[model samples]
Target chain A: MGDFLETDEKVLISLCKRGDLSAYDRLMQRYEKKVYALCFRMVGNQDDAADLAQEAFLKAFRALSSFNGQAQFSTWLYRIVTNTCLDEQRRQARRPQLLSLDKPLNTEDGQLLLTLPAEASDPLDTALSQETEAEIKTLLSMLPASQRIVLVLRDMEGYSYEEIAQILNINGGTVKSRLNRARARLRDLYLKKEELFRPTVHLNRKERRDRL
Target chain B: MSCEKFTKNMGAYLDCVLSGKELSEFQEHLSVCNTCRQEAEELQSMFSWLKQAGELTPPKDLRKSVLAELKKEQGRKGIRSFPGFSYAAPAAVVLIMLVVGNLSLLLPLHVSDAVPMRAAYQQESGTVTPPADAIIYTEDSPDNEQVSEKSELSSEVERNPSPRLLVLNLVLIPLFLFFSLRFQQNRKEAG
Candidate 1:
């Protein structure tokens, strides 16, 4: 239980492997938020995300010995989290529950209302309004697991193509193709609603300020 | 580039992985093809927005809860990994084999060979046929009476049955169960 306040991740991992629980705790604190974010986007809810993140950490702990430091610790850990979430979705898929198909989408306005605001505020704030983020999460959940994982890892989690390929255990080419398909599928789903396209997405301090 | 080819390459194109020749061809197609251009723009925006959606902070107690859960799980696995595998198990077989090895000396030494225990039960009087391979291992008594009853021979058989098989099975089973269970668990969740 030594103070790991300034310990490097590799040292923390080595300590964890040698049975130091607090070292593992330190390692966990470093990535818990990121892991939680991945789970949240993958599952589109906080509760399941929390559970998945926890399960992923436990898995990372158990499998710590085999983590040879070949990949970055974060990448290895993200792989576990990604797989944990994907496995859970697969389990859920097996016992299909009645879905609320008619659940109201957060995006109230249709495509007609899309326009750049005259006064450009923080683009992130405008682009990621609570409803917009919620809508994005919901739409992400709709994608098939294969496509969803690639999309989430690439688009939301910001893993590199090579990193994503390693995380999913696929080749880089496959990662690109899957990511492409995931993006395409997501686009189709977005267009299906036609209202999900937030007006702020493309309005980068320039024209297209009002609906035609 | 054909529209289909352009569509397939949209990912590479967006990623800026396309080379100069390919990039020029792709832009040329996009320049002329409205559908391909619009599709690329929309996906690009959508992808960027989703990226911008950004990370959310987990609940304060997430680490606490997960740590608590990890503790509980370790407790469970701790017991299984303890010095012995205990717990009233399933497929339980209560083998109550009475040790009758040394007790054979107390009885009149009537050792029966090849004949299974059903022998020595002659119904008629004085018409008893001794088992062909019956040997006398003990020299306790002066009168080595040739025992003539079924019960005596049956008791004799139980006292001298093979010790190796029972000891082997008993020693091997728990060890087998412990290792197999551990192996199965590792296989179930291996990385």
Candidate 2:
């Protein structure tokens, strides 16, 4: 048992494949915290994240025979955890989006401002720095799953673009574009929640013209 | 560059993927464009906050729960992988090898090393080896008669290899099919 702690990940995986339960436990211990944290960010909760992490681990164990070592083990495990959360998200009814990132938002200043949901009464009432992680997490949950995942991976988890591409099974260009879009959306969400909910009304091009 | 076009390149500019002339074009646009510059800075600050934010601490029991779940799965996997097909397939192989091994023991069949194959038998399965260090095949033990019979059979095969080989094949084919079918059934149940 102590020897397993000293073993590398590859040897531990091989031992796991050969039905060494202790080896798998060692591997689980190495990754459980990371997986749980990822799941929490994806699912936006603690209990559900724990359950999702466990489910992902079980699924990975069952599919162990198919896990060729082409990608790193952590990468493969992250893929499973991300997929598990996405699948769970699909099972539940999603909240309707108040603002669509796809819309071409034109402000009075002629700039396309991708602002947060107007439903927030006065989010910026408090100082931006006073904004809590809990608020950001909530705001993140409101973003589309596709965009949310990219933002979480690139911004919060700090995975490189290439690593995210491999984990998401997308190409590098797709990763960049998705990450850009995700950051844009998250910025809008966070700003709307923490800084944009202020005294000024951002009139669209048509609204300004009408007023003029 | 047009702001419309710059919109597409905004990500690249922020990512620093733009270079040389392309980079100059983006910077020149941002230098003149208040909106785009302000947007970039806001996006930059927001993302920096995300990056710098401390990771949430995972629940303390997360490891324990995952391990508990895995242990339960391991038990079920053990059950499904053992008995029935898995056990039968190997047992059948050992049975055929036992015939060949026992035949070689006395008569020297085509694949020799019969002599009751205690060592090979031990390797094939623990079926023959009793739990604990109990004596096996002692002079008065009931296992002795079966051991003697295997040796007698081996001598017969040593005298006649061709006929014995044909008979072993006949016994092997049906046993193979039977074990394989049962193994599939076990797999289906497990699945």
Candidate 3:
């Protein structure tokens, strides 16, 4: 955190309204991580998440004048992120492209970026963990966009029901109902993947035996 | 709470958003009912997994790229709001209005000619004169004097068609347009 990070958001917003680019940059730095995190979870793709997050910040800056300070700036930004992700999802559905080949495959020096190499020594453990993570992502992608957004806001992002409703521009009851349905749907999907859970069960049993 | 009600409220309960009394009842039910307990545990486990999976670091260059994009956008806005450029639209409108107004003044004043004055004069002469009471404007009447004054003013207008009002309208139209555009820009910025 910098000096601007310690400054109040209202002060920063005021400065941004005055066309202070530094203030806007500081605002971006403060919320960029959380915004990216939300976008990544919603889209389940890093490239799309990065694009969506960037678009969201740009939109926030453009529409900063319209921000009436009714909601927290973070909430407003989250709403933008959520809407951007949803729009991206809708666009992808219409076009149905498997990969964004137009995007660069590597850095300028031909160095691969975003490679998540496993630190674990056991290849089987690494493979199992990656598979389980992939399976969860698949299950999340299976949900309707609305339900998935509510689920991500509630369970993943730890937003309150009221905050999720405000962000989605829906009622609190609707958020709760959607969250419930999303949880139930996710549980059903997880149950269907019984094999994915078997390794964890075995690991737990083996650890228990070793402790005994 | 009944098992059915508990089932409906299970998600909210896991989130700990249930009302206090409802939460207590839910906990009591969970302690007693194996089915509800298992269901709650599964939901909790699923949520826990989602939380863990959702924690991802954004790319290192995202902030840099976003800032660069913001700078570009700001530059575009700066160009738009440049003092000279911002006033250019209104200035052009004023110039156009001035040229049009001057051209209109140079053109013949055909509006007076378009009126059927000969027919009006013939009708006034051919019509029967009204009775004294019906004729509201008597010779000694102030109304009669006012009618003569109005006719004299009309003749004066026919002799010299002044473009003062036309000039005023031309000036006002551009002024209105300029102010309206400025107002709209201000509103856009505020919004």
Which prediction has the highest DockQ against the true structure?
Answer: 1
* Docking quality band of candidate 1, CAPRI definitions: acceptable
Question: lDDT of candidate 1?
Answer: 0.69
Residue by residue across B142-164, what tens digits does model 1's lDDT show? 32333433435655565544464
Which of candidates 2 and 3 is the stronger one according to DockQ?
3
DockQ of all models, two decimals each:
0.33, 0.21, 0.29
The candidate that achieves the highest lDDT relative to the unseen native structure:
3
Residue range with the least summed lDDT across 10 consecutive positions in model 2 chain A: A113-122
Q: Model 3 chain B — which ten-residue stretch has the worst lDDT? A: B125-134
**Candidate 2 lDDT, tens digit per residue, A5-118?**
444888989988876768888888888877887887787666788889888887877677788988888899899988998888777546653454323345456434353442
Q: Could you tally the backbone clashes for each prediction?
A: 0, 5, 2
lDDT by residue (tens digit), candidate 3, A1-212? 55554458889999988878788888888888889988877776678888898889888888888898888888888898999999988887799555432121343444222223332334544324665565566667768888889988888778898899999999988887888888899898777666433322123455768989
Q: Write down the lDDT that model 2 would get.
A: 0.70
Candidate 3: residue A212 Cα off by (Å): 51
